[model samples]
Target: IEKEGWSGEVSGRRKDGSPITILITASLVKDEKGEPICMMDSFVDITERKFMEDELRIKDNAIASSLNGIVIGDLEGNITYVNDAFMELWGGDDISEIVGKSAVTFAEDEDKGRSIINVLQNEGNWTGEITGIRRDGIPITVQLSAGMVYNEKKEPICMMCSLVDITKRKEAEEKLQRSHEELEIRVQDRTKELTKANIKLKKEIEDRKIAENTLLKKEKELELKSLNLEEANTALKVLLRQGEKDKTELENKVLQNIKELVLPCIEKLKIYRLDDKQQAYLDILESNLNNIISPFLQKLSSKYMDFTPTEIQVANFVREGKPTKEIAELLNISERGIEFHRNNIRMKLGLKNRKTNLRTYLLSLA
Candidate 1:
């Protein structure tokens, strides 16, 4: 059975009995005849071609579904195809408006775009950041990586480009640059303040050094004056000791003169019989003579003491070996009052040490 100018695929077998797939083109072959005499068919094997077509469709679908914009351009840098992402990124709703344009037309910097194409043609690849303009005329920064697409023979056919929008990264970098400039300005201002503070600190240090030097000089002068004062005090102490010795000697001589020259005359007058009034006058003269030497005896009695009148009276009674009872009668007070005064005298004269007796301590002071 044969048909004229009608062909279709069908299951068949080769001479070797291996199954095969075929694409047949049907035609009529006759000698200059308009009517078909016999059917001539051309059989072509399409098994590998079908597999290649299916693979190409799968890859194309993947490219179309990608998030980053991707484009394919011919050898002349004219756009050949664009993914859905590319159209969306470029603000294009229709692919017809973008497919035939030069790939550089979307770049804000066309000069850099042309240079990138030139590099891709020579080196088979190019990748860099470039400014791209959307169809809406809004500009965006993008990272572009592109390489030549090859056919089955490894011949260069076109270039496929991948683009990622880096607009936020670029904007953040510019903001960081501005902040760095401000920080530099603040550092300069702080450095100036520190410089001024350093200058003031140097002045204060210089003033303190001068003050310390002056204080040291004054201290040396004070030490020299102290040495001179110490020597003067030593000489004054020696002179005071000599003067005390002379004073004691003068008192002894006066006492001796009075005892030797005047006392015998009073004794002789006492022996002579005299009226009561005259005897009273003679007694007063002898008593006044004894009063003249009393101060020197008082010095010996007190042992160079300067006690109050009551304390001196108490000390004299104790030294005279007067008991507490007799001393209290003489002082017109109780025995306890005499004991109290005796305790005070013992304390003021630094007595009562090692259980010393009040009478013995006062006698020793005398």
Candidate 2:
């Protein structure tokens, strides 16, 4: 062997042109002269082992950087290894403080620790939710998943466990459940209110229909009464017209009977001789008979509504062709009284201070 005898690890190339890793030992073969002749070197291939070592290193790094805690423990439940996440999860600052400790020391409950040991011993694996206590004595909830590490002979060696924190997730689920229940209660109350309102609305609609029907019936009755009143008014108008016609005919008949039947008898009485006073009486009777048939008296009385009965008599005598003296004597009044009545008649007839003859105006009325 040369100076150091053996080398630790060496890089080399194989005969197949592939890269390989090896461990080398070098020694010198000497002649009897005690001088170096040929150097002999032995190479041990470690390519497989190097590759396995690299893979293991990569896996170790991965475990250290994992978000979930990772742990390795022996069958006796003693901690053999732990990643950075595991140490941090248990509130530890260094791995040395946890490496030799019992794995069950992390469990918050005694029964949980016993159950975990029993599962590892009997079934060789365990996984479920568990409460874990930290170095600060604060408890946390985690989902633990563990499997048995086995040797080539299938014998159990150690236990590997992964822990995932689920405290926040559980709290969120409980809050959501409570909110769903409250929403359901509010919806039920709103539905009940709507049902009551719908019932009231239906009743109001029914009452409105009844009121409208009552109003319609009353309107029809009023319309029928209006029609009956219109018919009665028409019949009364016809009766009034007939009564006016009958009154006109009766007035004509009365005038005709006085002119034809009484006037001739009065004219024949003038032939008998009599005293002055007796003759005056007969003239007065004839004048009265002529006035009874004069139609102008009735017309003057109707035309001048304000004319007194005495004024009307004076007007009738004046219209019958009687002199003012005779009218005054017959009515037992003075001549000035007769003139006063005539002047009043002229004023009432709207002929005052005009040239129209009073006798002519009175006769024109006939």
Candidate maximizing TM-score? 2
TM-score of candidate 2 on Cα atoms, chains taken together: 0.52
> What lDDT score is found at residue 195 in candidate 2?
97
Error of 2 at 153 (Å): 3.0
Error of 1 at 99 (Å): 1.6
Off by over 4 Å in 2: 1-4, 28-40, 116-128, 206-366
lDDT of 2 by residue, 26-100 (tens): 888789997789898888899999999999999989988999999988887888998888787888887888888
Model 1 lDDT at residue 144: 92
Q: Choose the strongest candidate by lDDT.
A: 2
TM-score of each: 0.49, 0.52
Q: Which residue pairs collide, candidate 1?
A: none
